[model samples]
Target: MFTSRMFAAGAAGFALAAMGPAGTAHALHSDTFAADNAESAAVVSAQIADTGSLDGDCTGTAIAPHWVLTARHCIEPFPTPGGSVRLGQGDQQRRVQVDHWEAAPAGDIALLHTVEDMGLASYPTVSDTVPGLGAARLYGWSPDGSGKTTKLPVAEGEITELLDMSLFEGKQMINVDTHNGGKTQPGDSGGPLFVDGKVVGTLSASLGDDKDGMSDVAAYAVVAEQYDWVMETISGGGQGADAGTPGRGDLNAAWLVGGGGGVLVAIGASVVVLRGRGKSDAG
Candidate 1:
């Protein structure tokens, strides 16, 4: 199964231990997000914290006015379906009470449900299939080598091949290159990758934690393969909706931590560290 390490092993000190990209950690690389892009429909950014300090965690997107999509491992140490999603920035910013959080039974993809509308712009999934060999653009809110933040930074590269790593068994993964410094770093977990004008993948993991935040390689879960589960979850046709929210309690009480809201509770990083490569059966 796609585990937490698959999403943030670099940041949490797992794969490529010394060579991670999350701030001398693991995989967020490239430049700062353009200021104009923040106003683009539904592209949201978030930072995770706790009662003690700001952990500066993952990033995600609004799939619906009440639903957010991110890497399953991003919610480390915290129980899903209970944390709050701090969406947007500046005057347009707001928070979505994540009442429902469910990881796909298999892949690194996960969904967050809000009790109320987030009123953000959501990216459309491509109607046609994503070509095997094509260029892709990575986006995220993680700070870069220059320590830039408050904007969405993007990196351009190609979706070279399908991943053949063990962690991705039975999972459709796209091996995106981090060549020339393009990458997904610390705090960039769960960010989206765009192809053409639609989202084709979700940021997963990278091979190093170099100071630039760009790793030797990066991996993403193909959005096309994950579309079915995403749709089912959004329409209430998925599993875990009625599972009831547990952990730190409801959003209201759980959010008030450290000083303000957004503190995550009990989310831990996974220990598995496996390499991803090309597969013979690119399905």
Candidate 2:
């Protein structure tokens, strides 16, 4: 949860720039759909229950009708079922439902299944090839979790680097960086970063100090190369296709306790298991 001060401080500059009557109207209009109009814009949200309370955040996108791509860590498995997904939701909180979820822990990516069958019509199309130094935009609900209603804020940045092929712990990954200092915060993980209105990368990690300021770093994630696996998992089967089912060794109690951050250790194995479920059971 970001502090009110953080939200105020981050949004103040932009707010001030939009002062006065004309600015107010422009601000309202921009807040409505200006961000969604971009080729690289997508919406992602989640529902999680911790400490006996159901609370969650929004940060993700629709790469395919029934498929939404997000960060591995964002998928927090719950001891009990009842999690849900909201897509294309704007300030009003209106959204489409995603009925399923799957993830590849090795790639740090998650795919969402829509309940109502969202046609592949609105998804961003990615090229089989990677773009060099391409520009992109990012969108997500920047919740002012400081006791106020969550507000979705949008930011834009350029891709400074795109490592479509890299090895991490022996598993392949896609690394990326943006010119805009904008990044994924605690609730912003699993959002989508768009290029030319097409799905490019999932918002995974960022380089910075933690809330405690102990760890300073940069963040990245797996990209399009894993599309086949993602497709397979969403379509049902590739590797751990039985992940969603109970009693599987992969579906352990540790997932609920650790959330997405703790599952990094067995990402490779988890990816295989997660794909079987077709949706990350993690909150």
Candidate 3:
């Protein structure tokens, strides 16, 4: 279901492995974040870490004052005990502590309960129905090829496919085409896909055919499919019982890569390489 290699961005080694943009046209749009709550609302740059070191970066969305939504792979295997989310940018940019975490039972979705209110003017809500196949947009925090993080990049994507389940994790997914003209590179995992101004999915993985790791299509975990889990997890209250302090643990995660052969099911994101001393081997 994937190309020879599926490189994920955001993680330390992931950005280099995933290469750069594939299309000629730049898909960045500043107006996408111009709405109220703008800066902190997007839940930019989540630096997940344990007691050892910083794991990696992932994009997230502040759905509530104390809750941020992201891909489970960003904090899986061993839950992140402590981390910070970048709110606003430039002079206004500030890091807020993430005190707790909760992962969905069956999907790539997860929640990061922050210690402070995100201060979003208009928090984006999850959609109820399936996203109609058409125009859509995606937002994430990625580097600008120089290892320097870019201002939240918003790309114009098209919802081309809706599947009963994902090729990686068996969870419901949506295929967004950003190829030929615009594409998602590294550091985009856990990003949010906006369809009709509502959050429909979270960026899970990308599929490409080239060698640079530039992806023509992106797979998103359907938010509507995981709506109940997200709401219940958040409503259940403090930390969902699994949240705990950061501890020392080894992170050896794997991503599925395929080409013209058999398929493989990945229970985590397509790229889960940790960002510490060096790149860890795929589990």
Candidate 4:
């Protein structure tokens, strides 16, 4: 209900030299295996929904029951006529229609508006431009060594530096190590990067495709930098556009920016309640 669509049409323009088309990232590494089902709750497969069945080339996170965050490039031919976000697992899964989407004017990020509640718990986010250097983890439902997508997997590595890309020139990205012991394969686009038990970035592209669509250098749309746009959209009243929701009341943006130690007072936004990963820093 956040306005018929509060954001402007078309994606933000960015630098071509920054894009380079080199560092596009993908799915999971061959070694990655099934992760806990709890981890898969908030993650969803962004697939073609016109058909009854769901299959995805990319993934997204449910920032709210009625909204999803993904890569703009994932839904090419912008303003996709039809698509759906399938969340949860098995017979208990929920598939919601993808009505409208607004792309981040400058970066590879895009926000998909769902016609129904996603039926999944929303993930909490941060407002930091950079997620202080340390260990960061990636989560996605990419194929494993045998090309099997049995379950979602979690990848761990040190967040080395803030990468710069032509596609997202003005944006700051969190770079994770992929060559040595971890990396992302094809179909992993739009995954989430966690730091301090909060979402800090959305998996974008990567550098150097090893013929199979895997890469060592991956770039993510930093969550902190894009936080304002997200809160604003939800604040515009994401209930039903006509639900008569106010614009910006108790978004708890301040508490989110202060990190997750205080009790949140949910207002018009999704109440984010995530169990800590048992680490003070990204693991």
Candidate 5:
């Protein structure tokens, strides 16, 4: 099942520790205001449920006025109805209802529509440039259920080795290292990894023995390579807003290192990851 990590592990700390060699330790987590804090906080605080009860915390990003990007498994029906995506981290008053959801079951990506238009202070866009071998930051929420409120915090890290295309079956994924002892957990799936203010990838999976401390092995869904597909889906047709701007990184090289003969799962686009067992539900 898709589950959220607790605060005991320090969401930010776990992410940093798992970042491995390429990541750098930074004080970003201690900053008063985080990158995209207002929006991310809203998403972290919002309640998510698939059936009569809560299923798990789902992380999301504002790609457009009304669309949120998340993992397809979070909303997939598994003998039960899926949960909904909530925006606005700390503001309890701003709750937007989901109007609809679209996902490529084979790719593990999903887009959500809200009842009202949401104005983003900062919207994450794909950059044609990829960061060199170094640490960067990935932001999202960690659900601890410690008190009446849940918080989504931003964490920093560095870019590890960019995997090859063969690492993934279809979609693009990159490995990263975190700093400040932070890491991604189950609920962080679909979050955005920003480098120099540009979004390079989406949080997909992490390597960890337990729920607290995430392992050094972490992967993200590359957005640049999928810009065409994302634009096509978001635009409604071949003629909508253009979200296909490329980043600076070499996607072809990254793919060759990340993707090889990895296991390919059908979820929206084909998500290729290292062979493993724990196939948790997307939610």
Candidate 6:
């Protein structure tokens, strides 16, 4: 639980910019039919409970039985009141209340614990290494394209750069060129970027606007860099406000600098765990 003081401390870092209502990212030039796979099963929709809203506020992944991985900014203000996640796809979608959440003391990542076990047989595991340059897949729920009336939107793209300090200060991330497949728009935030069949990054931000037909550059938080923090949070069931790691204030500071003192993007967090992808330079 992030205390008021902690939240205030974190908020102080963003004094340069005013926090606004949360928004989601989307995917363009994507195929909704290609979402039929194992990875899509693990993907969940993050939404506000009792809102009666039809779509998810953001996207997330089930990393474990009852644990979900998402960008901290997606649940801005931390632990949204009645925050819940929707599992399954299309007509099978169901919403579950979040028991609690654990924000990494450093990165833009956060863990949501469901009130009950998700009972998932298989889910997308995190990748240990980060690929320098290669093809990757993007998954998310958006109100655009077929996503508006369908399930998940899957996009195929290529990793172009590994950024360190160029965007988020002291944070590691990767840039994917979705020019071939499509660009990530609102509502696609917090979604997973897959290399092979494992998750290597979580949607963060895009270099240029996708609507204006600029560059289809998408940035993601490097998962391997925060492996220890993620596992520990889930294993320990979150370190209450008094215990565990403390310093989201630092993350907030870096985030402000990373976003160029503008409205904070809905997604922009790191994932953990390592499977394929290759040796990660994230340290």
| Top model number, TM-score | 6
Q: How far off is residue 180 in model 5, in Å?
A: 1.6
TM-score of candidate 5 on Cα atoms, chains taken together: 0.62
Error of 2 at 272 (Å): 25
Candidate 4 has a TM-score of: 0.68
lDDT of 3 by residue, 20-89 (tens): 2122212222344323244335646676654322322567787666677877666653444577677665
Model 3 alpha-carbon drift over 4 Å, by segment:
1-40, 50-56, 144-147, 167-170, 237-283
Summarize candidate 6's per-residue lDDT along 1-283 as a digit string, tens digits.
0000000112222221233232232235544344456678787766633342445555678876667887655554433445567777678778788767665665556667787667666666666566668898887664453565356767777898786622233266688877445655445566788897777887765554424432366777787777767766655535432133223322221211111011232223321111010011011
List model 2 lDDT by residue over 36-102, tens digit each.
4323233545543222112244356655445556665445444432345544433544445544566
After superposing all C-alphas onto the true structure, candidate 5 shows an RMSD in angstroms of 11.1
How many angstroms is residue 44 displaced in model 1 relative to the true structure, after the best TM-score fit? Answer: 2.3
Q: What TM-score do all the candidates reach, one by one?
A: 0.65, 0.57, 0.69, 0.68, 0.62, 0.71
Residue 159's lDDT in candidate 3: 91
lDDT of 5 by residue, 1-283 (tens): 1122212122221111121111111111223224444334324321233331232345567665556665554454333323445555455425566656665534445566665666555455545545567766666543422111234466667777775532224345577876655544444566677776566666666534343334435567666656656655555532223244223232222221100011223222222222111123222
Q: Estimate the lDDT of model 3.
A: 0.54
TM-score: the better of candidates 1 and 2: 1
Predicted structure 6, TM vs. truth: 0.71
Q: Can you tell me which runs of candidate 2 are displaced by over 4 Å?
A: 1-42, 48-55, 76-81, 89-92, 95-99, 119-121, 145-151, 162-183, 210-218, 235-283
lDDT of candidate 1 over 137-215, digit per residue (tens) = 7666553323333445566778788764312232555777754555454556667777766666667665443443235
